[model samples]
Target: MVRPDKVEAVAEIAENFRGASASVVTEYRGLTMAQLTTLRRSLGDGATYRVAKNTLVKRAAEDAGVEGLDSMLVGPTAITFITGEPVDAAKALREFARTNQGLVIKGGFMEGRALSVDEVNRLADLESREVLLSKMAGAMKGTMAKAAGLFAAPASQVARLAQALADKRAEEGGAAPAAEAAPESDTDSAS
Candidate 1:
């Protein structure tokens, strides 16, 4: 028979797992209180890092329909539930672990796919979604501007050529060619 408190905890954990967009499992074997606080602060509102019983986590993972976490739920585990952009959370976790050696990134899951420890590191290596999007937008804008310039190039050249011809014709004489040219018998096609 399971205790009511344990059952409720499992339910809550399962709910969190279900609601989270992604989650990273970590081993907080020797992290101090201050370090944990700092890690949580660094993770900010994008993720929640909490310590849970391995058994409870297993149950919750199963209940939440999440996979690839059973092996990682060993030896004092803490999980980061990422609700916002996974890249941001991964970056924060990676940075925190880099500084605080006590934290170890075991593995993670995203969109029903299992990620190994190295994969998590690779995910952390990626830039934030907003930054990537902005860079792509800038690139697209530049490409559009270049296209617009290309589109107008021929028209602009034609206008310049016409203006130059007009200026040359004006410099030669203000009178029209028909007015200046008299009816001639020599070198005249319409004679």
Candidate 2:
């Protein structure tokens, strides 16, 4: 016998699970309401931090087809559902946990994989996507510049060689060879 409110809650939680790109579960056992509010503010607009009953969260996770979180659904639990960059959210959580001992990062799930606590820390250590993309773009641009230089090298070398040969021939008074090597006209011989 499920109450309508409980059913609605489950549906809402399940929707949050489905809509989130990544979710991290944490135990907020010793945190005060003020600390919780501060923590939520620190998470930024890209993430939503919500506290829910273990049973409801478990049910929601099951409904959303998200597994590997059953073991983390213990004690006073809150979940951070990240809609934006997972790395940013993970970093915020890790930082907040460092200062606020009450917040314990249990684990997280992202990119169709369950993340362990250490994995979540590693995720936090990663640079933002935009940074990584810009670095790769810079690398590619350098490669392209090198390729262009490589392509132009042979042509420039050939031009320099031709110019050098011309200068050497001019220096040796060799221009007369060009006039002397001209072909004789067949018409003059026929006449």
Question: lDDT values of the candidates?
Answer: 0.91, 0.92
lDDT of 1 by residue, 1-191 (tens): 98999899899999999999999999998999888998999998989999999999999999999988989998999999999999999999999888888899999989998789999999999998989999999999999999999999999999999999989889777666656565443448754
What's model 1's overall lDDT? Answer: 0.91
Total backbone collisions for each predicted model: 0, 0
Cα lDDT of model 2 overall? 0.92
TM-score of predicted structure 1: 0.86
In model 1, how large is the Cα lDDT of residue 94?
90
Worst ten in a row by lDDT for model 2: 178-187
In candidate 2 the C-alpha lDDT for residue 92 amounts to 96
